[model samples]
Target: MLGGGGSFRGGQDFFGRNNSNSISRSNKLIKSPFDNSNIPPFPSSTATATADQPIFRPSMDTDPDPEHSFFEPASTSPFTKSPWSSHFNSDALPSPADNTSFLPNILMGSLVREEGHIYSLAASRDLLYTGSDSKNIRVWKNHKEFSGFKSNSGLVKSIVIGGGKIFTGHQDGKVRVWKISSRDPSVHKRVGTLPTLGDYIKCSMRPSNYVEGRRRRNLWIKHFDAISSLSLSEDQAFLYSASWDKTFKVWRVSDSKCLESIEAHEDAVNTLVSSIDGMVYTGSADGSVKVWRRELQGKGTKHFFSQTLVKQECAVTALAVNDDATFVYCGSSDGVVNFWEREKSLSHGGVLRGHKLAILCLATAGHLLLSGSADMGICVWQRIASDHFCLSVLTGHTGPVKCLAVEKDNEVSEGERRWIVYSGSLDKSVKMWRVSEQPPSTFQRSPSFIPECSPTAGLLVNAPSFVIREQ
Candidate 1:
């Protein structure tokens, strides 16, 4: 479970419930990835220090004690004997039959600390920023700890970067602004916060600026609940934040002014993304994904509800769109990934069934799509035309994968594209992987055809058009 603290809904914890169990919580007490007994000691000479005393624990390479290992001996099959189990192999230990070449190669892993699990991640250029429940944000460059800063209150939940500034949404219902110092790039300073002091005072005097929230009247410019996700507009002119308060707010980036707040869902909004086509997509615990279109109305922008892409009994936990915004993927607590295609008028694309537990986070790099699940595995899918194929499964995390960030590997050749994928997990660690866009071989194999089962209906759903190459 995400032990620190957060909001909950519908008798379900913050991460939602799968079969009435918290998806992010595991009863298993496995050895830490950084356990000294299982791994070699870190070389002090390679450890970098910063003002905040950021610690960089190396990745786990040695074998773990079997009694304390999260992975168990495999049965006859890799997947569970459930209707939802995918045909794609998911063995705790990959066998020789599985094509090792297709798998995303693990680059390294780092333990943030024993106290806080990583909640969010943002990658910009060569720098990777990680946020956690400990109220700290740490920066890494070239897989080494570079710098860090602390927040007085609230665990960092979501982070986004634009215009050389980093925006972090917190559990305290405040969005903080940070910038690197002009003289020292390693030193980060908190410059301002969303709904700044000036805006709060200006809105407080007017009764019209207050809205009923959480059984109390609060400023419409402020969120009274934890901010679950944050996104910036394609043009970087506006910032969007979705909160457990069931509303999504828009702020002008230049002046840090709240422009609009819409009650987007009946329950908490878990994820939100602003696409390049001027459309905003939000998924929530309400079990629906909604789309909105923003337009200039007078001096401010107004968001008009466009459509609801999905509505189900299971809560939608994550959302991601491809580079061109041609496809939108939604992951629900039922361990299914549903997608839609813009060319088909955003119509329902078939589900990408793989994970046996809740999918907590998702990311995209070029034609590659990555889905992180509570099952402690990452599925790498490649998009070809309108269909998707599961290339390989990357497994290592001992807890629910909480967040993901991906950037192109600039060092790769022009003809060969590779992506650097960073996955943050509730295991209090982050793992890096290198993924190739193309398959290792051109040889083709027939894909497995498994019947899809709806979470609530118990009946077979649409047959997926996706293929799972023999692994």
Candidate 2:
């Protein structure tokens, strides 16, 4: 059993019930939040400087009368007379609005849940979209509001939003597009289905022969296996997909035609991300990450593709890019997070280590990176002074955290800096935390909102098509 404070108890039962008769509460219970009695003693000094002995002093008057005080008492006490008294009234504590905007940079919010585990999440403007293993897709307005339309069918693995439409990849080897009109609640409709490459292709055509012959290309939707991941260019001109068939394909969304296909990895490509610099990065189960680039020909022909970069180790499972595109962060099943710069080099700038199990998801905002892992925890890291680093490990989830979404509050009032992290876990719940000067000492377990045995395991937001499934 995975418990708070980094302790793992195995061999009892997988269902989280302790069956050992010898187990005692004192032995099973980990450190409490108030256990701060441990402290190292300081060394004694033979020579000490007092207040009257100044290290350096000007020739002017440096002393003042002791009775001339510079302090005054505040109107209220910082702490109440009783600990429980503070909880009796909401007004007893200061509101978040009263704090300075630039401090306490981390905030968290929990969104509504679907019938199953959330696998992927995407955000656009005021809408939050989620895809789940329950073969359902759900949309919510802001963090507090929920929308009614949910799809029914295969597990939604990947999702992307573009051209006022959402595109979703399903485990059943289908891609559906949906048009979302918030103005009319009843206007949500499926628009089209993309091709699936579920089997082997026997024919190959040269780029020139197909373009000059004006041949209509078949949709690459025929996947030999399940669609594992999907990504779109910054401009949404092309859609790229990675599948269990060991091939990555690029499709033109307008025509729904396969633009190019490359045998990018030896195993299933589990994740894909496209950068603003026109580079496509794919992470595979083969324990490697590959980068693809598009080559435009002189003639008006389809774009040719080639591999430009690769990481031979670390089965990359998730990816996130920094706000400035200066760095790319890849999370792997090896429990390591690698950072790469944009210079076509294979060197890593920094390695974030701490997760005991496979990292399943990652999200980035500004200089901060958030990672979710199979170890049932979230780790936050920030780039310090451009080179140094600091980390804060957040423990809470009893199961693997599969997806995360970050919301940047650019319009927060002065003195109030704000950022929200939304995470989806296999525990069947979402959690919210308020970030302050000190990390929270205790991890609170969220109540399971979705019933057990739901197939929801991944999340994809801002996708056009929705999916919902039962376990």
Candidate 3:
């Protein structure tokens, strides 16, 4: 945890011995949070730690007597009255920007866009997808707008990209699928939807009279509530959609078929993370983290309920798994990040504490665990071999940070790798941040901290289109 007397503790000689020290710190190596069979000491303001021993403290106070209960509650349902209002033409598409004029004074390395209430964001090899609370879902490349699509029914809550397709989860209880048309790259088609039920039979992508008829018959196969989040399998062959209806349904990506539905939690399923090897992780408002497995048995497939992590009684708000599948982060409404490990059953690692409110989103880039909170702040933590601790605190957004995505690229000028952070907030904008090795402030202006050239130094010029308008 970052301390009260917070002083920025980073910056070093670029390409010098001093860089070694910063790398060790950035690695965030430290003692487990649960050191002596108790909650390990929270990273004080004075020090930081790393991810090792997979130490997570199981809070006796947070975990009440547990029972096998997967029932759904009506009061806390994700299917409550939706705010979706149909307004735009279903046939009309988003037009290209009038010009490629760059936003004035646009921080070269850091970008801030004025897109509305950017709820969800995704990135492919070169293109970026921005999902807004409004009707538009914009696509950008090299920081310039490429194309966009719109949905009049609901706010886009979650998005995932795979297999040349974009899957979006909307508050209107629908999963919309899109693809860049082969015939027209500039035009993206609403290729398909999940649980199409009758729509599958209608053989049409757009809404039609049969939509309602198919919807009625699809109740059993579709999510009956708001889709909170979506995840794709390692091979992108399977797609998972979790809902406020306390259930998560599995779909076959090749055909948009609803394969299975599991009543996951007693409360709403808020977030989920998936591993490439058929491991599905789900966190719910019921304060539990359950693991599910999807496997193929010859020609047939199956989803097996695997394990559960009930470290706290607070709602599990966000989740992240490390790239190597060694550590699993389960963030709760009470501002705790619980760690888990693989190996058949889970290893109770320890909890990470810093946020004043619920943790809303998490992204693990290299050894850095970036956490966004309802407190309108993002905390960057380092995880090296053992020294784990907080590295920086970013404060600017007026609203809660809801989503985060990270992209890494080589910084040719700095001779190192740089991480560009893309954050989506209820504030209706997407902000970009550059994290790289830099020289100490006292010596000289570090090219990593702030560019000496244009604000887009350190290889941000290579970032895909969509620069922010200057304030």
Top TM-score hit: 1
lDDT to native, each model: 0.68, 0.51, 0.57
Residue-level lDDT tens digits of model 3 in 223-307: 7667778888777888888876667888889988777778787666778778756788888656578988877889768889987
User: How well is each residue in 154-263 modelled by candidate 1, as lDDT tens digits?
Assistant: 66888899988999898778998888878767777788888899999989999999998756999999999878889898889999999888899999999999999999
Model 2 residue 12 lDDT score: 22
Which of the predicted structures, 1 or 3, would earn the higher lDDT when compared with the native?
Answer: 1
For candidate 2, the per-residue lDDT at 255 reads 67
Clashes of each: 2, 47, 48
> In candidate 3, residue 260 scores what lDDT?
77
Expressed as tens digits, the lDDT of each residue in 119-187 for candidate 2 is 666666666667766555565553433342334436676667788788877765566677765665424
Model 2 ranges off by over 4 Å: 1-114, 148-153, 182-187, 196-221, 298-314, 343-346, 385-388, 415-417, 432-471
- On a 0 to 1 TM-score scale, where does candidate 3 land against the true structure? 0.66
In model 1, the number of clashes is 2
- Predict model 3's lDDT versus the native: 0.57
TM-score of each: 0.76, 0.64, 0.66
